[model samples]
Target: MHWTIPLTEPSLGAEEVDAVVRVLQRGWLTTGPVTEEFETAFARKMRVKHAIAVSNCTAALHLAHLLCGVSAGDEVICPDLSFVASAAAGRYNGATIRLAGVVSQDDLTISPKAIESLLTHRTKAIVVMHYAGFPCRMEEILAIARRNGLRVIEDCAHAPFAWTRIGHQAEFAGAIGDVGCFSFFGNKNMTTGEGGMLTTNDDDMARRARLLRSHGMTVPSFDRHKGHASGYDVVEVGYNYRLDEIRSAIGLCQLAKIDQLNEGRRQVSAWYREALQGLEEIQVPFLDRPLEQSSCHLMPVLVHGSYPEIKQQLANSGVQVSQHYQPISSFTAFGSGAAHSPFGPWCLLSLPLSPQMSREQVRYVTDCLREVLAQKQLV
Candidate 1:
């Protein structure tokens, strides 16, 4: 009998359980020392200055927008083929969002040309998502934003340490833009069940984010007790987006193994590339390029003609296949009345590739997909 495989699973281990138990023993299970340690380690690992932990990536992006001076009637340019939180970041700030071009069927990353067309005088910020852990064309996107005098916020919900290569070199994904946001949900490479991080080099943005993430309070609970005072004050309107110690505790241990985990995912991705290459029914573009310096946060494949059936076929074979997203603008909260356009609502499927999965298991999952495609004469 064949076994089942998950699309994306967290590479967790005993460290997570041990950390959780330690945090529980500490008794002050709210945001505290462990959260601070995780933030610092995250900042160092991502090569950023400041890291603000939050409830999730949505809150991180939302807080980033709020601190970036986004307001009602202001416009933010975003990629159409992104996770909903990317655009929702602007919506939470009461900003009008305009989603434009993403690399068509080739990893679905946003294109600079598509975004440049949407910019106007009201365009305050440009949120670029590293779709499926693949970095967008940052140099071109940054050039466009600079020409328009717009703030750049990287939606790194997909790509954490994934690097973007331009010309002969590469740089970490989140480190390129003004601010970067990351998700640590259970499905991510490293997870704390549900947590997020906001990273920035700007001191003021960091201060505001620190405050905004915790009720926009007059003080961080960490520093509150040092003054021997229990009463606190609110300086600005903020949300309860703080990451708790319990989650951070788990994150700290997971962070240590992130690179190894990413390497494992990369190996799985390479196996899929080798197995799925030369197939007419699908294409894996990112694979043809360099994988040595990349982090495989997701393994989204471009489905070719009449390929939707492959997803069902693979599922029936006990291989749990799924799409990375349905695009941000496809949802009613951000889309047209009801019938959202395919430009932002169409194809892109994530293949099973997790660090915890063995090489043999990875090959089997791709074998199932390969078998289905062959049966359907898709190749």
Candidate 2:
């Protein structure tokens, strides 16, 4: 079942294909020089001292938790509105997860006040996810961390090139905290098929994360292959979370033009806002947000009436849509049993969004949405 306009799609092309082919021709598939090159390029663009490429964002978060010394009986405060991996990463390190509510219905980022309220003797760190590419209020959140001596791990899956003002200067999403984790999944602003990046300004943490990324070895196989070392040593216990050369090469290509691609997403978002205006039953979040500051990773709207019926009707009209998430706390694994906000899974709908989306497509989606609401007498 194909929709006239899909929710999201990667803007892959000849460059990505050529990069993969070059990697295959080089005969080095695992983490190698190409991976290092990708890491360097990413770190430079992100304005971070170090960037360690990993298998996925979950792996990056897990590494961040381990490096921050999150362990059994400790608690990590995370956004209840984000993807489950935001909380699951801490659980992997044996840390208890403390759910933090969002700022409000209009701004879905983790609330700084909620984070402060959740702090306890066992609290070790705060994980803030920039919801839908909109940067979280980092200044207040960082102040909270400083006063509590807690680590701040930024989940930047939705915010690759996104930035915000901290003091008088602008800072990138992943570079503002103690450790920043990023995603390069297929649907993300950038794509590497399945990969992520861990960034930090702390030199010691960067060194440790690099060592821990590939089984805590004194020297990786790439160095050995190049005759840099005859033997290697395992210094610390680590997991096999290395990004392959093929994906790394692809990431290089994606990173080069991510800003342009993000601009296209912003345009689509603008069209959506224009087309969605005057609909009483529909409320678009981040209406005041400027496009330059965000990557515009998602286009979610809060429906005042029957969301399920609206969604089904839109689908029937050949429009594909999605939900950014159901609050992580609502999952049975987390055992919260309910959503944290009134704008929960059933009320929030992510409309079709992509760099390739055209104004006509956006108008069509909104037209269908208007029809659906009118049919249900929601507006």
RMSD (Å) per prediction = 2.7, 1.5
TM-score against truth, every candidate? 0.92, 0.97
Least accurate 10 contiguous residues by lDDT in model 1 = 337-346
Point to the candidate with the largest TM-score.
2
TM-score of model 1 (CA atoms): 0.92
* Model 2 Cα lDDT, one tens digit per residue, 202-301: 9999999988988899899989999989998999998899999999999999999898999999999999988988878888888888878999999999
Q: Give the CA lDDT, 0 to 100, for residue 187 in model 1.
A: 86
> Which sections of candidate 1 miss by over 4 Å?
1-3, 165-170, 226-230, 305-308, 337-347
Candidate 1, residues 1-379: lDDT per residue as tens digits?
2538867666677888988998898788788889999999999998789999999999888887887789999999988767778888898779999987666565467878788788889999999888667778888888887887888999888787888765666678878888899999988878899999999999999998988887879777877756656788898888889899999998899889888888887888788787777877676757645666666777777664343677778778778777666666667788763543343333467788787777788778778866876776644
Best prediction by lDDT: 2
Error of 1 at 274 (Å): 0.6
